[model samples]
Target: MGVVNVTQSQPVASMPEEDRKLSFREKVAATIGNMTGTMHNQIIATFLLFFYTDILEISPAYVAGLFLVARIIDAILVPVFGVFVDKVSTPWGKYVPYFAILGVPIAIFGWLTFTDFGLGANGNVIYVTATYLVYSILISIKYAPSNAVGPAITKRIDDRISMGQIGYIAIMLGALFASLAFQPLYKALGNGNDARGFSLIMGLVGLVGILVSIFQVTSLKERYINPNNSQKTPLKEMISAVFTNRSAVVLYIYVLALNLSNGIRTAIMIHYFKYFFNNEGLVVIYGAVSILPTFLGVMVSGPITRRFGIKINVLAASVVNVICMLSVMVIPDTKAGIIIFMALNAITAFFLGASTPAQGSMMPAAMDYTEWKTGKNVNGLMGSIQGFVQTLAMALAGSIAAWALHVVGYVPGVEQSSETIFGLKLLMGVLPAFVLLFTASILWFDISEEKQKQITKELAERRQQKS
Candidate 1:
């Protein structure tokens, strides 16, 4: 519904590979890029908070504030960087250089984020926060541009849909890879002292991830960068268009909730399984099993979406996520609890993957709508907000988990009080369920299938005119 004013300047055009379908090899390469991008973050998300609380001995409340403040800073930077991407280019490419060149710094900062050089409690607070912020900046540079790559790869719906599943599959693979390697490497390197082990583990693993990224990214091409977008389409107008597109707004809502819920759950899982379930090792099982279904879901999502359409695909995924999380509200003490919880958790992960392609398609669709309306591409600006949503949710998740720990009287490496145990249940289960359900409700307002067909037709004609 938001109309961008483009009368002031005309957009210069290039050949956009909007309709080109990727080959199997190209898809594999992109999947590698997506996988590598996810692995380092998954490492941080899975273990950094636990390290902060248990190893560094930072206060939970202060840790909460630390994460939240970084998010606030990240929120501001995401937009600035978004506009920067929209307005700038490099010899390497518009979006490619950010990931290709910046990958080294990202790995370095990622290592630094986990390293502790005898920083006292107060010093650790400052040091950890600084490293985290730098890491965030490097990630923002890499991730914002990377987000645009999928849309750039191809504009065909079926490809986007398949790419979505592939993208999510890649993400889960990264997370799974992190989970498998993280526990063993840290424990082995540290000689049972995880705090000391992480610096070594992160540095080594992060380097490998970055290397894979370089190989993967260089193999790919950016066929869709519109060189004149920034010259003609002002930043203000592009930002305005993001809000006016209801589908984009829906994306914002969905991402915020999705990231927040997942973050809270991820940030708390080590604690949840260890203290509440009295089976700390189950955390590894938890990681493996929860992500296992993603592959199956990805395989089936294409057929499912073609049959049901995108709107229903996304809605059903979120709704089932709610149900699965709700079923996890109470963890029983018997062996049956482990079996039951893992089963439900797998289902939750399945939907998460099943809906991924559909979810992935939404942002590109929203971007196309904006371009259709204004004849300008603002993928960079839109991608930044999506990245920001992840950061914002991660920030809130850390803060909330820490705050909840305080409320629950959670003491590290001790038998938790009954209230603490119950609180963990609610934090991991009830909270995320409700958040996801709220996210699903926003689906009703999304752009309908018929509307999308019309938009696609009109945009194709417009592109032909420019060609």
Candidate 2:
């Protein structure tokens, strides 16, 4: 609870002006942009694997192999995208212009990924793989800048937390829409043909994606620009700098574990509902039950972060989430048991949703810490590595889930054996519980709010001296 004393440091010879306050209109636009973007991404992560394996009858092993390869490529390209972002200077500034140029192509390819091209096994493989890779590349191109945009829009930690809350609302909205609507929409729209339904659904998502990019580029303004970003570092130097960031390293590891757990759980959820519950439609029911508590968690996250720093809040939420998940693992799968489990799931989802704002808030603070230590603000590089680690974790989860199902002799759309049922349950409940526990244990983040305050003060002093 110590107050950060910026005035103790030597005063600037002259202070010019304070950062401009973000308007409500801009905030709304930014929030919508994040909402739509996250919604589109959520659909891909949540439904695409099922679509590939179940609807299209593609070999899960083949799809899994492709997922692993694409992630490897993503790992390589993410940092390269980081370096590219750092080096480029445009009239719209470094981050915003990419949204304008790349948005359409990203949307189109994202749509194409879910479409049925009437391609046979070989043709389908090529079409799906090629389109997915291109969409991933475009997402990588935009993710760094899009993430960096939050910190750029505001420097005050409280303001950033408020923005984070808004963003989480967007996250929940996106997730809720995807979770509740995907099955029904596909059923109603596709009229029993899942491929066509998925295509139609994605076409709608694609249009929304384009509109989001337009809104973001047009309505948002970047107010905080790092003075150190003026000179571009070589890729080797950038990589070296990113690794040297201790807090960034910690955040990356934490994010990887978090996303990995979610990825595996998400990839297996439909199967669990279909086989274990004998009610495939229960997925939507669970989503419906989750909406209220999850929204409450997101709404309260900002105040909680303001009161007890983001690190503590995130850690506490993670621990609570683990406990809830453990309860889920032990609960029976009967009617009453399922109701209790869904209630617990709702509570756990709340904490998970609550932690998200803190998660987003941590990175920019880490970037500030990195700049304070290394005298270079590599937001693009930081964003890239964070994105890389997260994408890689999720990709790995999908690959592992696919392979795990294959190992257990899973046959889609058929009655599974007890062994396969146990495996699915393990994936859904037990393994993710362990992963969440591990995540909670390792989240010993050292970057406190007072430290961030000090960093912000020092960076401002440096910028004034430079000017």
Give stretches of model 1 more than 4 Å off: 1-18, 46-69, 111-132, 186-203, 268-276, 329-332, 405-424, 448-454
After TM-score superposition, what is the CA distance of residue 415 in candidate 2 from its true location, in Å? 6.9
- The most accurate candidate by lDDT is 1
Q: How does residue 201 of candidate 1 score in lDDT?
A: 87
What is the lDDT of every predicted structure here? 0.76, 0.76
Model 1 Cα lDDT, one tens digit per residue, 80-152 = 8888887777777777666667677887888888888887978998898888988877776565677766666
Deviation in Å, model 1, residue 213 alpha carbon: 3.8
- Among residues 3 or more apart in sequence or in different chains, the pairs in candidate 2 whose N, CA or C atoms overlap within 3 Å are none
Per-residue lDDT tens digits for candidate 2, residues 1-467, read 11223446764442433345567767666566566667767787678889888867789999878876777787888877777777676777777777777777888988898898888878888888888889877877667777666666666677667677788788777777886777799789999888888899889988988887788788877766753463655666666677877777778878887888878887888898888878878877877887787778888888787788788888887788767756655667688877887888888878867777777788888877766666665788788878878777877788778987898779998999999888787778778778766665345568788888777778778777666
Off by over 4 Å in 2: 1-8, 11-19, 45-68, 111-130, 182-203, 226-230, 271-278, 402-426, 441-443
**Clashes found in each candidate (C-alpha, N, C closer than 3 A):** 0, 0
> How far out, in Å, is residue 413 in model 1?
5.9
